[model samples]
Target: MELSVVVVNYNVRYFLEQCLVSVFAAIKGIEGEVWVVDNASTDGSVEMVKLKFPQVKLISNQTNLGFSKANNQAIKLAKGRYTLLLNPDTVVQEDTFRECINFMDTHPDAGGLTVKMIDGKGRYLPESKRGFPSPWASFCKIFGLTSLFPKSKLFAHYYLGHLDKNATHEIEIMPGAFMFLRSEVLKQVGLLDEQFFMYGEDIDLSYRILQHGYKNYYYPKCQIIHYKGESTKKGSLNYVIVFYKAMILFAQKHFSKQKQNHFVTMIKLAVAIRATASIIKRLIIKVWLPVTDFALMFLGAYLLIPWWEQFRHGVTNIYPRDILYALIGFYLLTWIMSLWLYGAYDKPQNLKSGAKGILYGTIAILVVYSILPQNFRFSRAIILILSAWSSLSITLNRILASTFIEGLLKWNARKKSVCFIGTASELKGSEELLIQAGFHRNNITHLLPEEVLDEHQRAKKEIIADAIKYKNISEIIFGTEGIPMTSIIHAMMYLSEFDIDFKIALHGGDSIVGSSSVEAQGELYTLEVIPLAKPVARRQKRIFDILSSALIIVLFPILWIFLVKPLMVFKSALQVFKGEKTWIGYNHPNISKQNSVLKPSVYLYSKWGKGLTSTVGLDFYYAQHFSITLEVSELIRNIFKTQD
Candidate 1:
């Protein structure tokens, strides 16, 4: 046997399928066998492998065995001269295997090799070539000296930034996304250390290869698209802890005690710094709009209060000092909280939502005024005028921020001018899928191939370049029907400098997969609908839960008369208030809770004597089309069945 490709897969079902499609295409004529060790993926990955790629050797683990242990399981069974550890989120070119094999055959002392890798966006990944993480390298990396001084050998040794990316060179370490090794070298260095579970094992193995008198090469002749962090989210706090802990473990195993201590301290410091930065970033993203809105609203109300006092009563000091400030604060808080409940602060800013929320809040303020003592009843004119001012101001702010200011800032703007490159049939199929995935038809531009082309491939490349340059295309989709993986790969490589997002539409597949940037996780544009998972839907749902639960508890005296078990109703409301349960959730046995975004609930909509098959069907419908009104109606209908 010449090559054995082992891919460790997690819950990236669609990415895994596309990767396997490319893998089989790459290994078409080679004497190679493929192995996929699935780590308890619940996303139908094992089933996909079994059904789609039957020739692949499969190892279905009952639980997550982590990366190293899973790869070791496959390596022990691999029967070939070269064992290639491939990530399931990567797509290889058709000639990638042949080129790597030829290079490996020529280099007698090369124990390990890795090809150049790009992210889903077609941007070159600097992790393709890296120096060993020594104490100085770690210091440089943790403090971001590597990024600032990328080509400086002293400051940027972490990624070996001074090296030419297009040329092959011997490197100290290889990325775990694509590590090719001679089986003989594996026998000498042993398998990946199980101690370093996921992040640092590749470095540990690379260091061991060097210790065993073999060279590690970074061969740039072959390139693959590594959709980074498909198996796990890299920006998450858990990822930070696990990755740095692995680094500390490597230091402990390899360095002296003093050096290990220094490295451990630096790792801890890096973790602390990252954790702080992550928290600050999250707070800024989640709270900035609300905070800014509140500040502006408060300022507006402050100005309105003084002017209203003078204009309405012909006196500035007529109202009580304490009551005036307190009531204004209360009013502003109520209005902003109502806006949040109505999803006004949601992304793609909804002006109608803001207007609606403020209208409800004004009605609420009028109701409170009617019930309050006569002494505390301020001017109704003031309240009415403030309501109009608040609504207009909020709408104008959101309009300017989302439409004009955010455009100038280029903050999370939607991509435009989408183009698809492929055969006629594949282009049509991809267009259908793109529309089904919710992309606007008007935004997509179908730039047809030049009909008078002599050399079709070269023409296609020129078409892509012209589309990017002239049309200012923000996104490009490559269809795999008539285009070879090599053509797609070369097009991406040659046009890597353009500011465009690249996605691959598998031939006859239902999804298109890509990442917008290096830091982003692999994103798939699919027809799957989970309304409750959207940010606006989730926030509104939680607000409904809180308000409904509070209302239930407050009106318990009257509500108890309609309930079979009144205390159970009270307890369920309390549970919902504490976020222990939702008001309505899926109850079908066949419908997995993991597949839905809702929590366990006190009430179920699909429990109306439906059979086994229809129970799941109803649950699916409920999950996809859930609303606060649906929950309210269901709760009212099932008022006497609270014990269930």
Candidate 2:
């Protein structure tokens, strides 16, 4: 074989599919075999390839052995003159593979080469080449000073930013995405060190290649898209912690004791400052504002209600002491119910904006007052006073809540990383769009096609496995064209099994419609929204349902017993008093006709300790007969009529 393409797969099946399709498309005439080493993907990735692409070789491991060990497994089995480690979430242009092969062939001294990388939006990734991570360089990176002083030679040296992008040059390290190596160079350097599971393995391999008297070239001619950091983005806190731990392992292996200590101290200091600032901000918003508002509302209600009563009633003390006590009790009960039903005391600093909270507070008060007996009722003036006070108080509370919560949400959002897999030009475009759309650059992790495991026969399987094992990929975005529909479907099936959200990039082709559907899991339905639809409406409906259900449950007992039950009982008593013995029947033209249609019945009942009284009522048999006739007539009319 001329070349071996190794890919370690985790759970990013859709992205892996697009990547493989692009690779196969690019290397159409090239002499090479693709190797996919699968690291125990629960997403059915192994099954997908077995069913779809039988030409490719696959090595399915029973467990997720780390990136280096798995890739090494495939490399040992590879029979190619050269090996390429490519990420499964990446895509290559038609000319990329041929160009890389020609460049490596011409430059015999070059042990490895990495192509220029771009993101889904067609912007160049900054992973073309990098310098060795020295103590000073690591410190500069940790402090973000390298980016701050990009034009300065001293600062730019850390990221190797001073290097020309138009020309190929020797560099200390090339990103793992497109690490192309000569089989001879690997023989001299030995296999990759499996000690570093993820982050440090590529660097260690590159270092060994150089130590064997070979140059590592950064070639910009060959281009590929790297969908960086797919595994870490899934909101798994453990993935983030593991990635950082891997970085520490890298530092410990390479850096001096003093440098390691310095990096550790800097990280500690940064975390301390961030935590301190957050705590102080939280105290000012959550504790101070809510307490102040509650006090203001209490004082305002006490003063306003008395003044309003004096103005309206003229003689405020006309009500007896017992009635006054009842009025006070009702006010307290209503206020307490409002607080509970309206979620008034729920960390006001975390509440949403708009009229939702205010509306709930108003409804709670109204429902409570409507339920209580008329003897316990306060003047309408008191209700008005409470309403105005509560509305203003809750609104003000939410405003403060919004300010604090929004800041916290933004802070949390900054920690999330997204990776795009496609061609370099495409990724560059994606990166630009994402930045314009408010994506933080620091959170983006690019996985270039070259970084995928090339020696592995099951490249897709290995790439997906590595993505899940090493990178904290929260989501995978496939950016490519002419990708096979079957492969896409296969990838989607695998991702669904893992509960991973995978999205395909729409590159202006025949639009894909009717692709969205819902999967029912018991009472919970997983609605797979098509990538094209705006997400706003779905989120809005969810909020509405949650709020409506909570309000109904909170008000059920009070509303049912006080208002609804009384109205129902009064309506029943009124029918009996009018000498309509039937509970539900029409009044007749003649008494005899009515008697023939509906017979009356009498019964006796007692109330509290009162004596029993006989009550006239409708006979069950005749009432049922008339009711059935009326219902049948209504059904006939409904069926025949065009309009209601």
Clashes of 2: 73
Best by TM-score: 1
Query: How much lDDT does each candidate structure score?
Result: 0.81, 0.56
- What are the models' TM-scores? 0.81, 0.52
Residue 35 deviation, candidate 2, in Å?
Answer: 3.0
With candidate 1 superimposed using the best TM-score fit, by how many Å does residue 53's alpha carbon deviate from the native? 4.4
Which lDDT tens digits does candidate 1 get at residues 1-644? 99999999988878998999999999989999999999988766787777778999999999998999999999999998999999998999889999988999999999999999988777889999999999999899989899999988999999999999999999999999999999999999999999977899999999999999999999998989988878878978789889999999999999999999999998999999998898886677677667777787777877887888888778787778788778778788889888887777665444567888899898888898889898888778878878888888887677666653332122222346788776677777777556644467777766544431225444356667787888778888877876677777777877778867889889877678887667666567653334455565677778888998899899998878887678988999999999988887766642443334466788777555434356655765665667777777787767665434
Which parts of model 2 are misplaced by more than 4 Å? 40-51, 60-63, 234-244, 255-644
- lDDT per residue for candidate 2 within 496-585, as digits (tens), equals 434444445534311111111121100100011111011222223233334433443455455445433445434433443344542233
Q: Name the runs in model 1 displaced over 4 angstroms.
A: 40-57, 60-63, 236-238, 277-287, 317-326, 342-415, 423-438, 448-459, 528-530, 542-596, 599-626, 630-644
Residue 7 local lDDT, model 1? 96
In candidate 1, position 388 carries an lDDT of 85
RMSD of each: 5.2, 20.0
TM-score, cand. 2 vs. native: 0.52
